[model samples]
Target: MALALSLKVAGLAAAATTILGVAVGFLLARASFPGRNVLDTLLTLPMVLPPTVLGYYLLVLLGRRSALGTWLLEEFGINLIFTWQGAVIAASVVAFPLVFKPARAAFESVDGQLEQAARVLGTSNTAVFFRVTLPLAWRGILAGVLLSFARALGEFGATLMVAGSIPGKTQTLSIAVYEAVQAGQDDVANTLVYIISAVCVAVLLTAGHLAPGRIARR
Candidate 1:
């Protein structure tokens, strides 16, 4: 059950990350504006910041006392604190940078000349991006998606902070292993650890297969 929940949350987070990451990444790769560098730095901050610090920021931003949180509660009665939804948000926040960086790199690698030619031929920017740029960069974007999913699956500190490891509610695989170890259940911890390791390895292998050229370049 914990494993299932973990996958569920991670999957949802990864999907959300992919949508937002792809947009932000493409913008970063192709567009330039006054605050582009600042936006890029802000987007990538989670990668370098400590997880606990990130969690704390999320808590402050989404907790009931904050304006958005208060509006959510009053308008929709949707509470993010200690909910599975909150877990998804926390995981997404931390995993976003992982997805963004590779996706941005992939977008940047695509031949700008091709896009320009397509535009000259009367293809709309949206059509050109979807039919040209995205298809060309899909391999690296897929790798980023896989990496984001793996990162989301393994998220611990932020999840614990926002979701509280509630049994059968937000107790993800990582939290389960943590609680198991705290209770001296070595066998349980080991089993969960092994499962997580296997999942991570599989994701990495698939990602590598998808972007062998990128891997080789790195």
Candidate 2:
């Protein structure tokens, strides 16, 4: 039961990560400032890096020793490292690239000329984005969001390294389920396995429902 709760927390982390990823994707797709490639590469770095490496870097940044960590503890009394929240942050950051790439692809697929036409008709760029581009790109964004959520739900190395499988405290389904399997407690792990399997099916189903053909009105 506690393990299942941890999984729930992890699920929240995935949702938060998808939200952040969508924002980043929007910026990357729409903005054309200098150093754009650098920003794009940075956004994508987490996807390529080993999960362990990304976890390690995050640990250094948010560990009890870091100023931000210390401030979080001092000001908000919030401790991230070794907590469920840390697990969420780790999972989200690692899964971010998955979300951003698809969302970016979706946004880029929109014809700039259509937006320009909207602008010529007295629509502001923001209005053009909201009215013209968003409706067309929503499917891609939804697809990316589903993919990111799935990746976050399955995050193992980063969640383990940062959260340390502390049973009810920090042990998410991915980690506790592993421990159960390793301890020959296959039955215990089975529950989590089924849950993850169900979640995967649900996300894919959602993506299908949100496919461009469905989201777009003829």
Candidate 3:
């Protein structure tokens, strides 16, 4: 159950990060405007902040007592706290920088001339992005997404704070390992640890192979 839940949360988080990260990365790479640097720093802040600190912030922003949370609950009948969906949100936020940074770098590394040529040939801006830019940057973006998935899969602190350890619901592999350790179940803890470590190592290896530098060299 823990492994299944972990995979589900990480998959959802990776999907969310891919869409938002790619859009924001493209915007940041192509546009010049005031506060761009500030926005970049804010987007990248999760990478450096303590996980518990991020969890606290998420709780304040998404808890029932908060305005957004209140509106969501009142209008949409949605409550994020102590739920698997909340775990997804927590994992997404924590893993976002893994996607965002690589996405931005990948987009930025794309040759402007190719996009310009597409535009000169009367291709729509959207088409230029799809046909000319995305293909070129996909390797790096995919590498980021893979890393984000691994990060989300192993997320512990923020998910624990927002989603709690609900067995078969919110108890992801990492959280299960924590519980096992706390309960002095050494065998269970070791098993979970080995599973998560193996998965993460596989993801890291794939991401490394698909990295922009390696792709460029290839």
Candidate 4:
């Protein structure tokens, strides 16, 4: 159950971060506006801030008693706290910078002349991005995405604060390991640790292979 939930939440978080990260990354790389650096730093905060601090921020912003939380409940009957969706959100925020920074670098590294040529050839802006820019930047973007997935898979602190482990529900692999150790289930804790470590190692290796320099060398 813990493994399955961890995969599910990580997958969702990866998907969410990929979309937002790619969009924001493209914006940052292609557009220069006031406060762009500030915006970038703010978006990247979750990566540097303590996990518990991020969790507390999430609680204040999304908890039942908060205005947005109350409005969401009143309008859509949705409550984020203590839910797997909440876990997804927490993981997504934490893993966002992993995706965002690399994506920005990747997009910036793309040859702008190629995109300009495509535009000059009557291709639409969207087409140029999809065909020229995205293809060129795919390697770095993918590396970041893989890293983000791994990060999400091992997420614990914020998920704990917002989702509250409830075994078979919000209890992911990392949380399960914590619970097992706390309960003196040495065997279970060791097994979970090994699993997470192995998975993370594999992901890191894969992401390394997808790095732009490595791919270029190939």
lDDT of 1 by residue, 25-90 (tens): 999999888999999999999898888998999999999999999999999999999999999999
The TM-score between candidate 4 and the true structure equals 0.98
By the TM-score metric, which is better: model 1 or model 2? Answer: 1
User: Model 2's lDDT to the true fold?
Assistant: 0.82
Q: How would you encode candidate 3's per-residue C-alpha lDDT over 1-218 as one tens digit per residue? A: 99999999999999999999999999999999999999999999999998899999999999999999999999999999999999999999999999999999999999999999999999999999999999999999999999999999999999999999999988999999999999999999999999999999999999999988876687
Count backbone clashes in candidate 2: 0
lDDT (tens digit, per residue) of candidate 2 on 117-202:
99999999778878998888877887877777777778889888888888778877788789999999989889888988888799
Q: Give the alpha-carbon lDDT of every model.
A: 0.95, 0.82, 0.95, 0.96
Clashing pairs in 4: none
Badly placed stretches (over 4 Å) of model 3 are none
Tens-place lDDT digits, model 4, residues 1-218: 99999999999999999999999999999999999999999999999999889999999999888999999999999999999999999999999999999999999999999999999999999999999999999999999999999999999999999999999989999999999999999999999999999999999999999999988888
- Candidate 1 lDDT for residue 78: 95
Colliding pairs, model 3? none
| Cα lDDT, model 1, residue 160 | 94
Compared with the true structure, the alpha-carbon lDDT of candidate 3 equals 0.95
Clashes of 4: 0
Runs in model 1 deviating more than 4 A are 212-218
How do these models rank on TM-score, best leading? 3, 4, 1, 2
